[model samples]
Target chain A: MTPLIEANRVSRTLADPEPFTLVCDASLSVAPGEMVAIVGPSGCGKSSLLYLLGLLDRPTSGSISIDGRVTEDLGEAERTHIRLERIGYVFQFHFLLPELTALANVALPMRRLARLTGDQIAERAAALLEKVGLGDGAGKRPERMSGGERQRVAIARALANDPAILLSDEPTGNLDSANTRMVIAEFQRLAHEEGRGVVCVTHDATVAAAADRRIHMLDGRIVAGD
Target chain B: MKGLMVLLDVAAAHLLMRVRQTVVAVAGVGVGVGFFLAVSGMMIGSQNDFIKTLIDSAPHIVASDEQRSAARQPALDAFPQAAVTVRGVRPQDEVRGLKDWPALLADARAIPGAVAAPTLVGAVAVRFAGRTEAVSLNGIDPRIEGKLAKIEESLIGGRLIDLEARPDGIIVTRPMADRLGAHVGDTLVVSSSAGTLQRMRIVALVDPDARAGFYAGDIAGYGLLRTAQVLFARPNVVNQIHVRLPNPQTAERDAARLEARWGYKWVSWEERSRDILNLLVVRDVIMYAVISAILVVASFGIYTAVSNSVADKRRDIAILRAMGFTERDVQVIFLAEGLAVGLIGVLVGFGLGTLLLEALSHAPLTMGGKPLVLPLDRGLRQYAVAGGASLVAALIAAWLPARKAASVDPVEILRGAA
Candidate 1:
């Protein structure tokens, strides 16, 4: 099957004050129904590579394609449009807006996409929360929920727009072992059962072992498991 | 537009998170707008009332027996451009009065909505009950002067027409009447500058508080034109013509036209009161400048509130960007927050201002020993101006902080979190 997200020799450099290379000649592809883990030690550019693939930051010298569409030459607005319609993001800290409840947080992306009625958005958000084992916590705010519950709510939010590609940056870095296991299982089900592409940048050994494929990086370059 | 609703929701949520700051900012704008309305209403209302009183108590145009320009020297008139200058040229002695006043009066009365009256003014002294007082005496025809002046309205004791019935009757101000210890039907000897003396009965007493018809001086007296003509030793002669028009705003133009036609000096009320009118303009500029300064100070409160909000929500902004929100979306959220505060503040201000004006209207004010209520202009234009200025200030204040929020890089924040 064609890859949902592909990076061709991608590299990111920061030139302010001095030149610094973050990701260099790092190439990878995430196919539908595949769970890929990019693992490395600190400052090895695992998250940087994931950012380039997610379209959050443009690659310095390589092309990025989402489901066969070249995104490097696209304008900022077009890149943002693709991110909204075709990709979802999950962060390490949950990052749920403190003012909103879990259901509202899940409905946020859907509301921005604006493809469904308000009623439909609410119903789908509730279902996504149920799928992530947060059915009873839809009305709870992030501050009121446990770490595990918050991470699960974050997962439900990532599925809001029904995007084909999911990119998570250290999603389980702040969760306990049990929560980490739960989040890993959720990712597995999303990739295997729901047929979605899942890419996680993580240091957790358990997450790397559970993923269908592991891409390892060292010193800003992918050294093995491409 | 549907997406805008979501951004508004996010903006509202952020404001709710810091409720105290939002309320304080809104209150600042509210106070600014309220005071603006009340102060502007009072100042403008009094100005309009004073102007109306001025127009009503005085003639719109006064055509006096004087020349606009100095009479040309006969030698200069004979030589269009003479090399030799005539120094210290003496003016010709002539009687001071309109040459054909009856015909001029007829033409003046023919103008649209004009009420013209002729008067002869002279200085006189009245003696009664061992008291003698100097008075500026106005000789008027009761029938025409009634329509031109408010003499009938100002009378305290008897009717103005009584002067016409009693050919030797006169009217005196209350102050003059009291000083002379004179009463109605009392006889007093009046002497004019021409050394002519006549005995006249006191027919009416004018209220001192009534400003119309009476000169604003120590003592004023009025009598029939024939009585004054005979007393002043100038029979069948009028010295001044006073005219009131339907529209006082056109007085300047009408005065110019009348001056050109009648060959006499005509003065409009606006020209007579130019200094006072200029002072009013300066006062208005100062009032608006002070009010605008207050609003600008109030807008700083909004700036501080929104700036703090942007700082507190930087992380949330990054996460929203990662979720595909554009920089423009972030800008809209903050702008909406500022506008919401301004809109709510304007509504509260309107209520507060109306209540304040209502309370001030019944204040205990006295003028000339008579109870007076404060005049307040409750026009809609003041509200629109105050609200518009406040909203514009608020939007500008919000724009600065919103621009900062929109430019935040999500990758930096997300990586820092990791």
Candidate 2:
């Protein structure tokens, strides 16, 4: 089967007064049901490479493909639609909208896609929250929840659309070790048990140890584990 | 529909987070709309009031014989295609009267929607007690004049029927009666410019001060048609024909048709008050300009609020975009916030305006020594205009900030925070 996500010789460079290269000639791919962790020092372009693969940022001179469909030339609207339907992203911080309840935050992506009715959306959001260990925090706002609970709610929100590939950028940077452990376990189950492709950028050894494979980056290039 | 609901929900959540700022923006627009309504209502209402006074107090149309230098000569009448100039054209100094006025009056009465009457109007000097005053005397058939002008309604002491009972009878304005120290049964001598004198008994007195007050130059007295004709030394002739149409708005058109058919000078009330009517139009333009300025100033407040909202919610915008919301959706959410504020303000403003108008309408007023009421035009058109204008102002003010919010780059913001 084709890789769930493929980036062929991708490079992202910043156009600025003092120019800088974020990712250079980095080609990588992840097959279905694989959990891959990108490990690197700070300013080693790990998050930058992940952003390009997740279709959140444009590469300067290379292309990306998700589920064997190339996405380099798609318009902003098409890219957004693909992001809504094909990919999910979790950030370092929970980043849940402070005004919405935990359930509503999980349902935001589903509502934007509008493929489900209001009741179906709500029901699916509730199930997702329960799956992430946030069943009791459904009606509570993010401000009222603990940091670990909020991060779990964010994970539930990312999975609301049942995307094929899950991407994370420093997913546990703001969490305690206990919360980080819970998040790492969730990523493992999402890839191994649910048979979804998972890619996470992390500095923690425990998170990298749980992954099926690890890619190391240095100076904007994939140094190993191609 | 479902997509719109989500947008609205997001907009409501955002606004609810900034309750105090939202209230301030809403109140700003509300005050703007209220002031607009009050000022515009008063201006339009007073315009209507003045127009009503003009239409009610005078004949809707007056058709009179044109003043000309001389009758056409045989040469001027018979010569075909001739531009003949006659030297030394002299005006005939004769008493101005319409020839065959009774037949013309009958023809005028035949017109539809017109109340027609022949009036022999002349200037007379009245001597009573020790005072002599120059007064305008209107000679009319009491029955026809009563229908055209509400002569009976102005009667203070005696009825208009008294003039019919006594042919040597007159009705004088109360100010004139007071100046002459005359009563209902007193006799006064009235002499025309031609030195023709008649002693007429005052049968009634009308107080013009009751409604539209009489001006100092408006000394008015009335008599029977025959009495005026004898006093002016003219028989079977009237100088003026007055017609009151069913609708004063259509008087100008009817007067134009009458002048075309009768070969006379016809003047409608609209033409008579053109100068004041033009001033009213100018007043309206100035009123709208001032009101719009106030609204623009009020919109600035909304602008600041929306701008700050965009700044405060930049992170949220980036998050929404990452969640797959289109830029258009983000823009619409902010625009909806502005529209909600405007709609709420308009509703509150209209209520306040209604109360203000009610207060104004009941307040006592006077103009020209007569009691008057403030004309408050409570029409729906003005309210709609005010509401629509305020909504537009709010939308315009919100547009820039909404665009700013939509253009926020998720990568730039997300990477910065990370």
Candidate 3:
């Protein structure tokens, strides 16, 4: 099976007077329909690696390929376009626009990608929201929604373009245990049933345990993988 | 640009959020524009009327002698050896001796820079048509008067006085014309300022000021200088010879030179209507001060409104930055709000100002000697200036706020908001 993303000898260094390396000598491949979770302690560069993998950040020294396109060599606009069309981000804070409703938030990725008609985009957004258990709350703004619901909406928003890969940074960090389990279960279903690869960075052992494979990061270096 | 479009949307939202403050700020500017139009219109109208009156009555500068005792004038100032004669002149006559009336006229006509200065004399009746009023009579040379004043232009319902033909004809103002129930060719008798009575026929009626106090159908402008002198028993000598200046204001230097050359006195129109012209200038100052006060208040309103919006929208701007909206976008959003306010203000101001001016024009308001007439076309420049000032004020007021929005920290805003 073709790998949707590959990172070769990637290293990201934080430039400052102290100059600590966020990710040092790391390499990884994410295959189609794979569910991978990165487990880490505080300051372990798990989120930074996720950012680099999602093309939202560039590695200091490495080659990153997304579906065979070299992201490191791409211009800023082209990198952003790749992020818009093929990479969906789910952050712990959701970052949904307060002025927009759940439906608009979920439709955002499609809106930027320009690959779907308005009606098709709306239909897909509705189905995604339905899959995330927000069947009738499309018109509600993020501020009006519960934290769990907003995170769910963010998850739905991430799948907006039906990208081959999903990247999440602390996706279940702000949710209650029940909501976290449900969200983890949804990610499992998306990987297994929908056949889309997803990479998640998490501090919670339960979320890491739920993934089909796990990688533990310590001090900006990957220590073990399962 | 799409970014600009989004910026406008943001601006529109901003305007909607603080509707009352925005409306008040806009209204303040609108009033300023309106006030500009109204006041400037009145001033410009008055100015235009005054200038037109002066122009229509050409030879804007008229040099006239004040002495009225002499029976005749030298026909040619340049002709040092012209013959002069008079019927009742003594050998020791203090008056200059003259002979050959026809030859004197011919010699006078031939002088450089000196056109014909035909002369006239007549008296206004103290009482006419049962209405008693002290009125001064004037003697005039038709051809010479036409060059110096709008003698023919002001004649409303009658022909101008024909000095060549009737020679006994006179013109009157519309009010005086109406008072006597007189028209062209109507006979009217007038007594001089010195108690000399003479009868003359009305040939024309004219009004120098149309707003009030006079009419085109009423002051008597007599036809011929000869007939006037003959009727009033004054021969040859004339009070006030209207000399045309080549260049109007520059003539002051030349006038001083002429005064030195001929020992004659002079007065500029500014000197003639010193009080009113001074008043006009003071009124202009007061107008600027008043409009400035409104602008200062509006400027404060703009400052408060834009600053307040900046504070409220800081997070939104930061989020935009985080989402890759450039600093330029942030600046444009706030500035666009200010501009939108100014545009709406200008539109409202024009409506309000034009309405007020039209109302005043139609209303019966009189000032000093003229009725109010708003000249909108003349007021347009002032309107634009005031509107531009308001726009600049809004933009300047928005400056600090826009800078704040541009420099907002995305992480801090999210942290604080969360």
TM-score values for chain B across all models: 0.88, 0.89, 0.63
User: Predictions ranked by DockQ, top down?
Assistant: 1, 2, 3
- lDDT per residue as tens, model 3, A37-150: 998787788877887887756899988999987788787667656766677777788778676789977875565455677788889999999989998999998889999999
TM-score of each: 0.89, 0.91, 0.62
Q: What is the per-residue lDDT of model 3 for residues B1-418, given as tens digits with 9 covering 90 to 100?
A: 6425546666786788688989988887788777777777777676767645443343333334432234344443446587654465543354321233334334333434544354444445634566654344566777666655556666665654464566667666667766667666677776665456667777666764533222222344455666666655667755444444444455345445444533334444444556877887887788778876777677677777788888877766754554445566778888888778877888888898888778767887667766755444445677777788888977887887888888786544643443
Off by over 4 Å in 1: B70-95, B99-114, B127-134, B143-151, B178-186, B210-215, B232-239, B260-263, B365-370
Model 2, docking class: medium
TM-score of 3: 0.62
* Candidate scoring better on lDDT of 1 and 2: 1
lDDT of 1 by residue, A10-62 (tens): 99999987999999998888999999999999999999998899899999998
Per-residue lDDT of candidate 1, residues B1-418 (tens digit): 7598899999999989899999999999999889888998898888887777667666788878889787777777888877768898777776977778887787777888899988888899999999999988889888877777566888877998999899899998888988999988899999999999999999998885775434444587889998899999988888888888888898999889888888888899899889999999999999999998988988898899899999999899999998889999999999989988888888888888888888889888898788877878899999999999999999999999999999999999888877
The positional error of residue A32 in candidate 1, measured at the CA in angstroms, is 3.1
Cα lDDT for residue B223, candidate 3: 50
Candidates 1 and 2 compared by TM-score, better number: 2
Query: How do the candidates rank by TM-score, highest first?
Result: 2, 1, 3
Question: What's the lDDT of the predicted structure labeled candidate 1?
Answer: 0.89
